[model samples]
Target: MTKPIKILSFNIQSGMGMDNRRSLSRIAWVIKCSGADLVGLQETDKYMKRSCFSSQARKLARLLGMHYVFGGACKPAFFSRFGNTILSKYPIKGHKNTLLPGTGEQRALLDVLININNKKIRFCNTHLGLSTSSRQKQVNKIIELLGEIQLPTILTGDFNTTPNDPVIEQLRACLERKSVSTESKNNDLKTYPSDRPSEKLDYIFLSAHWKEICQTTLPGQASDHLPLLAAARFIS
Candidate 1:
């Protein structure tokens, strides 16, 4: 029997009016068309330039009929900026959203618990810093934050660092410490440079506690970056 779990991670580029100034609809379309069970969104900016309207997070959730979560870019979120957001079709048990310890355009890690057929799956999503050095620090902070989570986990997001980078190497080591079989042959799909992709800054890594059945990148253009999706069967 085959149980397919559709997971997707996208850095929507803050919807900075690039899609004919139709950010909300674009996001909704992506959510609807992609048909993801769980989605991790980076650069999921939740506010208008003037902060007059509802958050983009709430708007997108309402549109997709999914539970929503957001991690503010600041530790205390002094400026009330959006960092990362997660949308889940399944009922959420709980979540932890917080900013990474760094001084940049504001970044955060969102830890959410999702109930899948009476089983809980933990998702850790985040968008890392832009610079290499900043990304290193951000990756370290993410690792630190992840240590607190006690559940079957799937780390998905636009980490902003390629697999070759030292930061990414360290992150890979610290996370997914348990070795799982990788049956995916689509690891070569690049996700950045939206127009014509190159390099993989996004990923969906399984925890030792779960057995990944399949993984691949969704094909289509819904945003600046392509989405990375994976399906895993929990080991009982």
Candidate 2:
């Protein structure tokens, strides 16, 4: 029997919680408690003064004892960069970062290949733009990239849009929404504005080769957005 893989997606808002506190340790603690074998993070800062110039991705990986790769969507300053990151308990074999089409703040898709249980699997992490037009274009680009990968893939991120949005609808046509559950009660799928989550912005999509076991949002004030966690086993 194959072990179920635990996956998590979170938009940490540079480690700022709803209470306006910035603590990477808190974020790490939430992830650690989740016991996620794979984690995709958005809005991470690298050498940014606002977050005390800490390398958020590296620090979290170190704290959790995992391998990680960061993709900078934009460099607001010469020494500071912000973007998405992926952490895995397994070894990362390769990675690529591509900037998406957007008129507002730059966004990126981080594609990574990792060896999990001696099997290669592709993991893609991204953060979409706020505008509908930009999100449409970004979604198109993501779909295009997804077509090029042959391995069983898992895509996770903070899409900045609700589940009913057309962008999400388009993605559903190509991949399975692994984080959504029919049995969820009391709006458990909502992941934004952690204090009072009223929107479903974060998501995890998996290829047909995986079967979802369970999914839920982790409770924590580590960031403005709550973490989405899911477990699945490879069908093959």
Candidate 3:
């Protein structure tokens, strides 16, 4: 029997905390405390000035001793290369980044393949658009990309919308029938505006090929959005 996969999804906001202090160490500590097997991160910097022109993904991966892949969505005014990141305990066999359709900021989806206990697993990470209409179109594009999944897959990231939003419904229509729960002890479970969260933005999704063990949104702190932790077992 294969062990369950421990997963975490966080939008680190380029490693800035609620106090306006930038510390990758703090971000790494949050992830380490989770004991996660795989992590999907958003708003990461690739040699950006704000982050001291350092590779934030590489730094965090090194801190956790995990393999990482940084997908650059776009460069803002030639100041930084920003996008999504995936950190995993297992070696990445292959990966790709798909640019989503949007009128606002350029967005991207990162899909990576890895083998765990002889099981092929696909980890899909993304940060969707901000506006409702843009998010709707981005969700449609993501659905098409997820269609190629031939193995057990976990889709996660900061989706920038409440669970009941129509965009989520559209995504549900494409995902395999499975219960994707986001229950936390804290009843509200909001994730934006770190100081006092007021929105359910981050998420973790599992395919029917997997069974959910548990899921929850961690308290906001290191970023504008709180981190979401989820665990599941792959079904043969």
Candidate 4:
């Protein structure tokens, strides 16, 4: 029997906490404490001035002793870039970044294939556009990509929308929402504005090959958005 894999998704806002302090170590601590086997992060900086030129993905990977891959959403500028990342305790076999169609702040979908306990799984991480139309287009692209892969997949990110939105409904049609546990009584899964969350912008979706064991939101001020942790096992 395979043990359940713990997955986490977080928008670290470049490691800037609600208290206005940028600390990659602090962000790493939150992820470490979650005991996540796979992690997807958004708004990570790489050699960017604002975040003190730190490669947030590399820093966190080193801090947690995990393998990582970063996909730059923004155009390169003097060796600096910003985008999404995937960190895995398992070996990452291959990875790529696909640019999503959007007007402002170029978004990207980071796709990676990981070998977990001899079973291969596709892990995708993304941060969608703020506009509804843009999100719709991005979602379509994501769906198209999912159709091309036959392996079990897990998608995670800050969707920038609530559960009631039509986009969420569209995604739920193809992938199962595994972040919300039926056994848990907590109805509110809001993750934005870490200080006082009112919106549920973060999410985790899985393919039919997996079964959800449990899920929960972690309490922390390491980033503006709270982290979501979910545990799931392969159905086979």
RMSD of each: 2.9, 2.4, 2.2, 2.3
Tally clashing residue pairs in candidate 1.
0
lDDT of 3 by residue, 109-143 (tens): 99999878667889999999889989988998998
Write the number of the candidate with greater TM-score, choosing between 2 and 3. 2
Q: Could you tell me which 10 consecutive residues in candidate 1 have the lowest summed lDDT?
A: 45-54
- In candidate 4, which residue pairs clash? none
Which of the numbered candidates is closest to the native, going by highest lDDT? 2
Q: 41-112, model 1: which lDDT tens digit per residue?
A: 887654445334457788889999999888777433334466788899989889998777666777778989
Per-candidate local distance difference test: 0.74, 0.89, 0.84, 0.88
CA displacement after TM-score superposition, residue 75 of candidate 2 (Å): 1.1
In order, how many clashes per candidate?
0, 0, 0, 0
Q: Per-prediction TM-score, please?
A: 0.86, 0.94, 0.93, 0.94
Off by over 4 Å in 3: 77-79, 178-188
Rank candidates by lDDT, best first. 2, 4, 3, 1
Superposed model 2: Cα runs more than 4 Å off? 177-188
Show model 1 residue runs off by greater than 4 Å: 16-20, 50-52, 74-80, 148-150, 181-187
